[model samples]
Target: MISRIVRWAAQLVILAGIAAFIGALSVAPAFTYRPADMAFIRINFTHGAPRAECWRPTQAELTKLPPSQRRPNDCPRERPAIVLRFELDGVVLLDESLPPSGLSRDSPSPIYRGFSVAPGPHRLHLAMRDNPRTKEYDYTSDFDVMLSPQQNLVIGFDPRSGGFRIR
Candidate 1:
């Protein structure tokens, strides 16, 4: 009787350990930082021009696109574009511009502002498409940003002030 009781207790311990291990493994991915999630910073363009408008893709709209079209590099060519370039620790992680319609653009927007950056102190730079007759305006700003785990950074362009803010 004593031996049987001991065996049962050992089995229960082993089963509990296995269950705990599986639980940890399942949650580990959520806790760990994914490279893709941190690859590009978000630059939100909310202020639209007099006739220009800005909108984000809904889940249904995103699903409507084919997998090939959903890629970051597969943006369609269009006008009135917005591109976001992200730098982390002074290193550029991603740099590509897209139109307000999420299409590709040959030149970046005129009012270039804001960038998403990794969690740390970083130097942010903005470049705008300019005509040869116009003066070039590239702005650089330094910020100490700290992003918590699973945090999505948002840099906004406020038309009223013609400036950017991190939210």
Candidate 2:
């Protein structure tokens, strides 16, 4: 009876020590994504660039091609690179071009970028040129946003809906 009582007491003490250690860990601040006063900006999108105009085959070219493989107006499957520019407040954040993906270089380009910044009123500028013909940005948007601490801002694009969307 005495040995059993002593074992129970020891087990209770060990359990209490573990509980206190866990409680202390729970009260300590350790893990954090970003600084307490910082905010986040992310731009992610996939877009297909416009292909160049198709060309019709000449008589000589048609004769050279196999009968089953001959095409009158052969269109190009390769697309151009995608141009993107981003400006935050009055400063430029990003300005670069991204090439198309896939083995044939005919697939949509995927882009993802992130930035950490101070929280408050900010001016967001976004622009993209998906067409080879256009000299300037084919799509553009500007917004004034108020960001709180640890807030996340995401920018997206969809050509069918006319481009840039913010969330």
Candidate 3:
């Protein structure tokens, strides 16, 4: 009877070990899992103008405007000479290239585009190019953004008087 009980206990232990091994395998894939709803941010310049030519603004031009006249916070009193296309997740989502020529003081129309995201933790980084005319300036801005599930996100560029603002 003693030998028989010991054998039964050993068998139980082996079965429990197998169950644990299978459970670990099933959970392992979740650790490396990335959601399928990932999206990318893109910029499209209107009229095929080079990014450099379209976004370059002289310091003198920026200084002439009142603080509130700048972009991201204020729509251009005059429509931008250039149009910018913004997209998310590879779709042609926003076409802001042909905005109306005039805007009121309070209308800070967003010039940047945004994308919807699923719930999960995310990271965003800004990428830009400096205009030779204004070494301190970025003529084009790129962003690498990540989002978690059920997260609602909006991303856009504001040419704040030729400076880049991402929100």
Best by TM-score: 2
Candidate 2, residue 8: the lDDT equals: 100
lDDT of each: 0.52, 0.91, 0.45
In model 2, state the lDDT of residue 65. Answer: 94
How well does each candidate superpose onto the true structure, as a TM-score?
0.39, 0.76, 0.30
Cα RMSD (angstroms) for every candidate in the order listed: 13.7, 3.1, 15.6
Q: If the candidates were sorted by their TM-score against the true structure, best first, what order would they fall in? A: 2, 1, 3
Residue 52, candidate 3: alpha-carbon lDDT: 27
Backbone clashes under 3 angstroms, per model: 2, 0, 10
TM-score of 3: 0.30
Instruction: Give the per-residue lDDT of model 3 (tens digit) for 19-126.
Output: 999998987766533345653333322221122223444667777888765443332233223344343444545544343223432222234344544444444433
Mark the regions of model 2 whose C-alpha exceeds 4 Å error after superposition.
1-29, 63-69
lDDT of 1 at 116: 34
**Best candidate, lDDT:** 2
Clashing pairs in 2: none
